[model samples]
Structure formats: structure tokens, C-alpha cells
Target: MKKTPNFKMFMFLMVVFVNTSYSQDVVYSAIFKNVNKTAENLKHHLNTSGDTLYLESKFDLNRIEIIGTDGLKTFAINNITKDIRVPLNSLPMGDYTFAVVQTEGRDDTYIYTKTIVFKISRLLPIDMDISRGITPLNASIYLAGGTIPILDLAENKIITDFPAAMDLASMEDNKPVHLDYTSMESLVALQEKENLDAKHLRTKKIDNILERNKPAYSKAYNITDIRSGNQNIQSRADYRRNNLRPNGLPYD
Candidate 1:
């Protein structure tokens, strides 16, 4: 018996063919050195209050396009100069690829394109807490950013209903804590109390020593002399310190 043609397979093949064809037509050329340099010098500022993405470029931009990770265009601009500020509050929080095309020379002979990827994350205030365990703490936990969620794991299951913030008294004991989010993938638990105290004491000691020796450092560096209003007197003092003659003799 003759087999029937697969309609679903045929539709899938058609979709793939059209997508591949479209992608081939929109190929991105390698970024030119000048354009790449300009992009490297570009400064990006995210203004949360204004909900805008401020971009400052060194060179003239022919086009600026923001493309989602799914290959969909979200925003675009053309014939923009050194400064381009686009509102980004409407866009969802995720990774986005920015394509910048620049032109140079009177005839716009030199064309360059550069692509940069950036992530937009939701701003959430993270609260952390620590408790003492039965054993004396020997290690210290260092937290870099204050945005990771703290989790507790005991019997191979993750505890999510733990308190957002907790106050543990001195000499109190509790179980080890884990991180709920992948942002703290490298971290295992919070620092123990004894270790934390030791670190704080060391930091305090160093700060105190610095404070005590501050006068010596100031005397050795003497940067305040440069800020003095008398330029003529300062110049003469500098010349004398270098043993240069006051008769405008160029020091060899």
C-alpha cells in the first residue's frame, strides 16, 4: 500500500526554510576597527527614575537596533549623533543584543557594525540573616552583592518559607543556610559568628591604625600644598625642592 504524505512534517520543513532564508538575508557584517573603537568608548547609563537607556557614542551612528535573544527587533533608531537616549522601561527584564552601525568619512565610505549584549534585571532589595550553630564557627562568609535570596535545605528539600529577615542573639544556634537563587551559585552558607567577629575586629584594627598614621601619610605626600592659592610661591617652592635655578634655567 502507498503511504500518505505527512502534512505536519511538510509544514515544519516550510517554516524552517523560510526562517533560514530570512536570517541569511539579514547577515551582520564584522565590526570595523573604528566603529568597534567607538562602540568600546560608548557609555551606557540606565536611569531608573527616568526609565531610559542613555547612550553616548564617540562617533556618528547610522543605526541603533535593540534585538531580543529570540531574534526579534524591539527598538531601532537612524541617523543619530553622539548622544542617543531611548526609553527602556517598557521592555521586559531580560537579555538584549544591541546592534550599532556607524559610518565615517565625507562620502561615508567606511561602514562598521558592532553588537553588544546587556542584561536588564529587576531591582529587588535582598535581606540576609545569620544564626549560630552548635559548633564554633571557623569560616567566614563574604557577600558581594545584596540581591541574592537566602534558602535553607535540610532533608534534601529546599526550604522557601523561611523568614525574609531574622534576628539571632549571641551564642544562639541554627542550621546552615543555602542560597535560593542561582545568582549565589558559588556561595554555600553565611559566615559563622566567631569568624564574622574576628573579621570585624581585624577591619577595625586596620582602620584604627590608618587613622592613627593619617597625619604621617599627609606629611609625606603633602598634596595639600598644590591646592594652596599662591601659584607663584608654590612654583618657587617646587623649583627650590628640585634644586633648579630661579633664573628660568631649564633643568637638564
Candidate 2:
């Protein structure tokens, strides 16, 4: 296995644009915005405004830390690869800094870390849009909680039936384009308690222009079906229940 390189050698950042004039920062110590070789440090300038916050990396990203301006850690979550989940709705409107940590496979061996910056324009209190009559940027809207909000620059009111509050417009000469960073990769169940799926098909009604024009790219999906799950001991008693926690590796 290839070991991670030293972070000191790659500790500078250059600005990058994903699909717009301005993109969400990734400060990944590279000049080009698109680099795919896993051997090298990989990161993307992701500008998004969806509720399902995630990234485009070949690394096994496992943790996320939401930080404040004074370098105070507000929240930290391990097992982030389960879904690069960041609870955007629960947070109030403000600038937030993210520390996305990637580890070597399933272990605690650290590989690389990067910073992502975004600003939440307006938050409609808790369960009600008590102030929709007032607009922050004239294009502001309210969300009903549950969906993630990455970089909300939406001109229309936000859709409450969906899972993410993605930045869904590209209207201005300098406005950010839809970069498809808001990945709906079958990881999240769109139907939840707060969603209004039973009342109407508001979700299905959403028209993602990029999704429609995009060709069904010929791509194959693969993963280690069976992994030697986390365990310190491997006695004979453990093998009796070796279903998910197979004694050996996925492949010999």
C-alpha cells in the first residue's frame, strides 16, 4: 500500500473555480481545479447550496469538523463517509469553515485534510418562515429543515420536499454555475419525517437541467463487499458469527 506524503511539502493554496466565476473553496494546495490521480493529494473547489453536503475525492473521507472564526471547534463527526453529512439547517446564518479529514482506508492513519468555506445567507428561524415577508438578498427563501444547505444563492423559494438545499441557478455573468457537487448517489433516503412526500410529488417535479442533459455515463460501481471489520481480537469464538465480520480480508 502507498503511504501518504508529508503535508509540509504540500501546504500552499491557490484559488480555483469549479463551474462558476466563484466557487466554494477547497484550499487543497494545487493550482488546477481538476486533478484525479489518487497518488497525489486530490481536492476540488466545490461551490454548492444543497442540503446534502459532500465532496468529490478519491480518498476515504471519514471525518468533518465545523469550526468558528476564532478557531473554536463547534462540532466534529467521525464516520463521515457514511455520507459527508453536515447539519446545515440546524445552524444559523453565518460564515462557516469546514475541516474535511481523509484517512487511509478504514484505519486512523491520517492522509490529508482540506478547508471548505461557505456562507449561509438567511435562516428562517426553526419550523416557520415567520419572516419570508422580509428578504435578505431578494432571492432568499425558507427551508423546512432536514435538507443540507451548502451555498444557497437560489432565486426562488427553497423546496422543502427534497433532501438538500443546492445552489440551483446560473443566471448572472459572475454567478456560480451548477457544478453537480450535490451528489444524489442513492446514499440518502429522500423520504423522511419532515418531507412532504405523501402530500404531493414536489420532489419529483424538480427539474435538474444538468441531470436531464447528462448522458448516462458508462460507469461501473465496485466496493469491498466484505471487510475485516474493526476488532482487536480474533479468537475461534469470533468465527462462529463471521458473517459481516469475516475473519480474513475481503480478498486473500
Candidate 3:
């Protein structure tokens, strides 16, 4: 009636195995880029609040660390696939500087950092046209150092895409039209028709440096800007026609 020694050993082994299985750690990951500039406000949806953030370097696996306002904290992750996505839910609502070492085994490796300013608050109505350019309507829209342009309506309730400049040869067919600001039906329809043309792709391919350093990073493709050479002439024509729609008419 004495307890067997083999049974006691088996129970201890089972406890150790169960403890090891339950102590699984979560990994953090993100990729880095050498591109000169990127979109400032890259917002992401959050599932819950008060999440811990871990920063993993795409170039160096050993450089993974926890980034906080107080200082750096060491952490590990499974992989880093794209731009560094660290949770800022626990941090105060304000500007923050995220800094990390770019390479491992080298102390002189570049210190990469980005400044992000964000606020957790209600949204506001934005005037897209005024954000993009200035036209003959006595209002300004374009700003210095801005690559993209925005066009605003007469009432300024909504904004439109930059007007396409028409050539003199197309002057006969060109006229301004008012469109329903509630929906972007015309732009969407036009995009489906004239999108992905050979001309546009050819222009974009030549202007961007996507095929550099073959065999090293052969699969890597980079795009800075897309230049089609032709202005938005067709878009201007569509706008002019739509603007012609009267307050109550079908196509007015």
C-alpha cells in the first residue's frame, strides 16, 4: 500500500511540461524603409486600450527593443515585416520620438527615429480644396512645397480634385459644370474607364527607381511619384458638364 516512486516522478514531469507550455511569450515586429519621405498620419484601428508596444528592426534581429518616453527597454519579437507599428495607447496624447539602432554588431550604426504627433479626440469637417490650391474664384488653394493640389467648390462646403487644364484644341468641348457634392460618382466612374493605361504606367516606371541592385534586393520595388505628363483635361470636362445641372433638373 505504499505510493510508488515512479508515479511521483511522472507527476513532477507532467507539472513541469504544463508550466512550460503555459508560459508562452508574445512577439513584436515591424519593417523599416530607406525612403526619404512617408505619409505623416498613418492611422491604425486599435482593438483595446493600454497595450504594450515592442519595436523590432527589419535589418537587425538583435536590435529589437521596447521604446518608451522614459528610455529604451529590451524586448524580442518573432519578425519584422513592414513599417514599425508600435502601440501608443499607453503613452500620453501628444508628440513622441521613436528612436532605434539600425544595425547590429556595429556601434556606429545609424540612429533612426521619427516624430509623431497625435491626439485622441473628435473629428472635424475639412475643406479639401482650400488644402490644395488657389483659383480664379478669388480663393487660394495651392501651397508652397505641396506636390498634390485640392480644389474647393463655390460654397466651400466640399472639395474637388484639381481641375484639369484643357488645351485650346479641346476648347469647343470644354465647359464648367456643377456636381453633387454628396457623392463622388463621376470621379469613380471616370477612374474605372481611364485607369492603368500604358502611358501612365510607362511614365511612372521610368520616373521611379524600382529595379536597383538586382540579386541583392531584386524583388524590392520603390515608387516616389506618378507622373502621367497629361493634365486632368478629361476630369475638367466632366466637372464642367456636371456643374451645368440645374437645382431640380435630372442631369442639371
Best-fitting candidate, scored by lDDT = 1
Candidate 3: stretches off by over 4 Å:
1-58, 61-69, 78-84, 104-252
The C-alpha TM-scores of every prediction are 0.29, 0.28, 0.18
1-252: candidate 3 lDDT, tens digit per residue: 232475346445644643453233211111222223332223222212212232233353322333435564443322332223333323443222233333323446654443332212111112322344312122121221122211111222212233555556676566676678545787887676677576688877876756553434221122333435652233434555555444655443
- Report model 2's TM-score to 2 decimal places: 0.28
Ranking by lDDT: 1, 2, 3
Model 1, span 1-252: residue lDDT tens:
121254335434644643464323211111112233435756665542223445666666555555554565533333345655453434454434455555443445645655444333222111111221112112112211122221111122212233345566555465567556864643433446567889999999999999988743222223356544433333444555666455877565
Query: Which 10-residue span in candidate 3 carries the lowest summed lDDT?
Result: 117-126
When 1 and 2 are scored with lDDT, the better candidate is 1
C-alpha local distance difference test of each model: 0.42, 0.36, 0.34
| Model 1 misplaced regions, further than 4 Å | 1-38, 48-50, 74-76, 106-110, 113-117, 122-252
- Tens digit per residue, CA lDDT, model 2, 1-252: 121243222221111131132222211112112233442443433223222343444555544555544454533333333223332445454344455555545436644554433222222232232333321221113433444323322221223245556676666657765534344433244545336665446645554555687655321222423334452334444434443335655322
Model 3, backbone clash pairs (residues 3+ apart or across chains), number? 18
As a whole number from 0 to 100, the lDDT of residue 171 in candidate 1 is 55
Of the candidates numbered 1 and 3, which has the greater TM-score value?
A: 1
lDDT of 3: 0.34
* Top of the candidates by TM-score: 1
Ranking by TM-score: 1, 2, 3
